[model samples]
Target: MRPGADIQAFMGRLGYEFAQPELLIRALTHGSIATATRPDNQRLEFLGDRVLGLVMAEALFKADKAAQEGQLAPRYNTLVRGETCAAVARDIGLGDVLKLGRSEMMSGGRRKDALLADAMEAVLAAIYLDGGFSAAEQVILRLWATRLASIDDDPRDAKTALQEWAQAHGMQPPAYEQTARSGPDHAPVFHITVRLDDGSMADAKGAGTKRSIEQEAAQKLLSRLEGGQ
Candidate 1:
């Protein structure tokens, strides 16, 4: 494939094309690249976070009219969340296009979920800037429609999954306690501890609702229990 061919293809899948290729480059640039050495994607990521959220909220609100805010919010969080973005980036080969510093490249920054998610957000910002909100909405809906569509009030809940997994194994359900919280009230980093009845425990950190954080902590503990190293 040519240099930006895959990116262009991804945009094609996204139903928008950038007027400026530099916007895409900036989106793919990591903070490890440095502002002095290379203007990184931080500003674009900031813009993207807002744009992505707006697009997602509108889609979710429109799709499930019977769903209340309490029910729809967490599902919305997971669809645009870091893990989902990282999965999409890997799926679309965005990780290979990432421009990282030597240290970051060596340290496996390309595979980092947080970075991938930020890059995805930056890409959304770039699309929005180069095109418009319509473009950004196109990117978001393309990436997130399936995730949003599959959500409901039944077996898909993270808390429910964690509980069922534990119960089936003849163990008590995982216990979650909010260990710490910081940042402004609007943006908090929730630290949650997930403890199994058998004394197994794992601490996971995430920036989102407590339900999301607890799900993360439980997922981590589940991984360790299932013998993931």
Candidate 2:
């Protein structure tokens, strides 16, 4: 069966035409709206998770041939994590084509990170099933090209790095405090401050999620400490 106009538009953004249109349809169908006839994307999500993992692992291995397993593992995790997948899904406007129930729609399901990430994986699974691993690899590589190129050599996030720095200095783990929160429930902004035992502190504000704001704060603090501030 042919996809609808909206799904076709999504396919244009996704950069792959589906031979089995039903697979794409299934991939986009969320559990909240699913029925016996129209199943959800959970199983495909499972398969796609593994597919994404393998692709990222191989890419990282080839990208840094001399890197040890410990180094490559974190890079692989950075690429295949849910946050990265959701970022890619947003790039292709996957949320616009998601089939959601009324409750989920009212709750801003389209903007949710987890939902988008799962659907992205499910869609990749559909691509793999429709055109095999080579086609799926081509699509994955194209979509992730920029991220793969710019991925940091140090895979540890700012928070982890900050804690490690403190440990090496014989200090306690840095503390993060949410100093403020604003905006509506669906799109809230967070203000986070990371403080060290030595009274050094850094603050950062961001929208999307509190954890991200905290990470930004931690990064700022880490940078300051590393810069001899």
Candidate 3:
């Protein structure tokens, strides 16, 4: 069967066309909207995670021949992590085509990082199953070309980097506290503060998971410290 206009547009953004359009539909199907006959994307997500890891590992390995495992490992992690996948999904407007139940739709499922990431992986798996490894690799490489080119040597997440900085300066590990929370339960905004032992602190507000807000807060503090504030 042929895909609708929206799906075609999505494919245009993804730079891949599905031979079996049903696979793309299935990949966009979330558990909330899936029936027994029309399974969810969870299984595809599982497979896609491994496929993404392999592709990223190979890409990192080939990108820097002289780099050791220590250097490549972090870069691989940075690329295949859920946040990166979610960012890629957002770039392609994957959320706009997600098939969700009323509850999930009301709860803002499209904007949820975990949901977007899972769907992104499922889409990758669909591409793999529809075409072949080469096809999936090509899609991943194209989608992640910018990230692949500019990944940091350390590639540590902000929270980890902040803790290391504190340790290096003879201070205790940074602490995170959720100072405020508002909005509805399903879509809440969090205010987080990251404090160091030396009385340095930074606060940030984010709409999503508390962990993400903590990371933002840590990044803010890290940036300030690095700037000699």
Best by lDDT: 3
lDDT of 2 by residue, 1-229 (tens): 9789999999999999998999999999999999999999999999999888888888888989899988887788889988899999999999999999998888778988899999999999999999999888889999999999999878788888999998998899999998899987667789899998899999999887676788899999989899998
For each candidate, give its TM-score against the true structure.
Answer: 0.68, 0.89, 0.92
Taking the tens digit of each residue's C-alpha lDDT, what string does model 3 give over 13-82? 9999899999999999999999989999999999999999999999999889999999998899999999
Highest-TM-score candidate: 3
Candidates sorted on TM-score, descending: 3, 2, 1
The local lDDT score (0 to 100) that residue 64 gets in candidate 1 is 82
**Stretches of candidate 1 exceeding 4 Å from the true structure:** 1-15, 154-229
Error of 3 at 141 (Å): 0.5
State in Å the error of residue 154, model 2: 1.4
Candidate 1's residue-wise lDDT over 1-229, tens digit each?
2336767776665566678878888898887786775689999999998998888888878888898987777777777677787777777667778888888887567766787889888888999999889877877787776777776554244566678778998988888899899876546689999887778888988775676788888777767767745
Model 2, position 104, has a per-residue lDDT of: 88
* lDDT ranking of the models: 3, 2, 1
RMSD (Cα, Å) for all candidates, in order, is 9.2, 2.0, 1.8
Following a full C-alpha superposition, what root-mean-square deviation does model 1 have from the true structure? 9.2
Error of 1 at 28 (Å): 0.8
lDDT at residue 107 of model 2 (Cα atoms): 72
